[model samples]
Target: MGDTGMPRAFIPRPSPCAPPSPISVFATIDSPPWTLAMSTYGYENCVAGTFYGFTKTEFNPGDTFSLQWGAIDDGATPLNITLGRAGGYIIDEIIVGAQFTKTSALYQLVVDDTANCTLEEFSWAIPDDFNTTDPQYQIGLFNASVLLGADGVPLFGWQAWNPDFYVRPVSSTTTTDASSTTSTVAATATGGNTTTTTSATSLSTFSASPTSSSVSDDSTSNSETIGIGVGVGVGVAALAAVLLGAFYLRRRRKKAQTPSQGLGGVRQQYIQELPATEKRPPMHELAG
Candidate 1:
């Protein structure tokens, strides 16, 4: 073993159940030295004949990126590079000595592990704290198994896909605090989020609240008109009823006067026809 406490890899014998092996008892365990590199937007420093992969260069808070790695060979175990198992690190994208992973965690994207198969691939999404200005995030080969050399350093064997690249953040333009009168629509929304616009035509925005207000005004005007029409109709009906009542009373009075006058005239005519002698009547019977 090297000075480090880690143990070096060695060849293993065949199965005990098999017949006596004809091959030599001793063999050389040929392996390479440990290597570490970084990747960033439009840049990567990968060791020859190693397993590492990455899919995208830019992303937003919740966007996803694809990743892949090569499988470990037989009779070898992957080195656990993370000081904390299941944890890892990333290099700076824009500034030296700066940590890109300081803003967010690099998650492993894998489906199966029953067999640490080679040529595996997976995906991961950019975390909420992922920086947008310098968007590239680099990570070591996930799910890749490495052999520990005598120096206790991890060494890669083969790779399946590209290991490093840049992921650009999605750009957008939004508006907030937009208020407009009922006359004209404006280019703003309630949630304070707005779409990117180049010209006035592109920002032809509308507001439901303002439209509803106008509709309410029209409804009030219509209600007033309806109320006036009802009042006029009621007044006309009342006048017509009054005139009809007056005409009916006058006709009844005229009919009653006509009958009385006719009776008086007939009585006068009969008296005149009687002559003066007939008028004396039995008054000749005198004072008896």
Candidate 2:
């Protein structure tokens, strides 16, 4: 061991490279099915050639690049960018911001997480322009499978379905009022008294009177006719009774007179026939 604590060997410090600047991708969703706005921030870095097992590869500039939210086999169009490629490359440095812009499409999105599950999975589609007035630019992602990164991990956490816009009334109110009024004219005899009340309001008006006299008259011609009919019925019944009594009396007189008359005639005939025999057949006279 050299002299205790004799200034340790001077180790030259390594120079630090500048950290990569964060990139931002702004996205706004104006469509019906989705309404989302976000800014994705990230950094770009070049991978080592040895990592790809290719020693002769060269980086190419001015080539096309794309960053998709879903897996390569998901059948979704990748969010793309046009760039130049220089030479051969494995993983090129295409700086992507941490934030991204997104918006909804016209058609609604319905995502199901589990088969037959009532809970619905939520998703949003992105449009090219945020200020586009035409609704056609809206991109709709319906029942889309969750997006996955190269590492096979979900890009975003779980999200619930929600509407983008809201509606409100211009004005509203609630109030009510009702009232009424009354007028009366009265001419009364010596101790008569009368009173009236009236009220008026925006909704309605009312009026009342303590006393009122209004009569309707109907003629009694029908009653007079009915009385005449009753009188005629009584007269007819009396006439029928008198006629029946006369007939009964005549019949009784005829029956009683006939008996007496018949008896008288028979007696007369018998006396006329028995006169001679009666003179000779006087028994007491003959025996004397």
Best candidate according to TM-score: 1
Can you give the lDDT of residue 43 in candidate 1? 24
Model 2 residue runs over 4 Å out of place are: 1-219, 275-288
lDDT of 1 by residue, 1-288 (tens): 223222223323234354321221112112221111122223233232244544344345665544434323321322121111111222311111111121112212222333333332223445556555644434442122223231344222212224444544444411221223411343352333343333333445444557879999999999999999999999999999999999999999999999989999999999999877544535355474
Give the number of colliding residue pairs in candidate 2: 40
Tens-place lDDT digits, model 2, residues 107-158: 1212223321111112222223322232121111111122212123221211
What would the TM-score be for candidate 1 when compared with the true structure? 0.29
Which residue pairs collide in model 1, if any? 51-159, 53-163, 57-166, 57-167, 57-168, 58-167, 58-168, 71-118, 71-119, 78-146
The C-alpha lDDT values of all candidates are 0.38, 0.27
- Using lDDT as the measure, which candidate wins? 1
lDDT of 1: 0.38
Lowest summed lDDT across 10 adjacent residues in model 1 is found at 93-102
lDDT of 1 at 223: 100
* Model 2 TM-score, all chains together: 0.24
Candidate 1 colliding pairs, count: 10
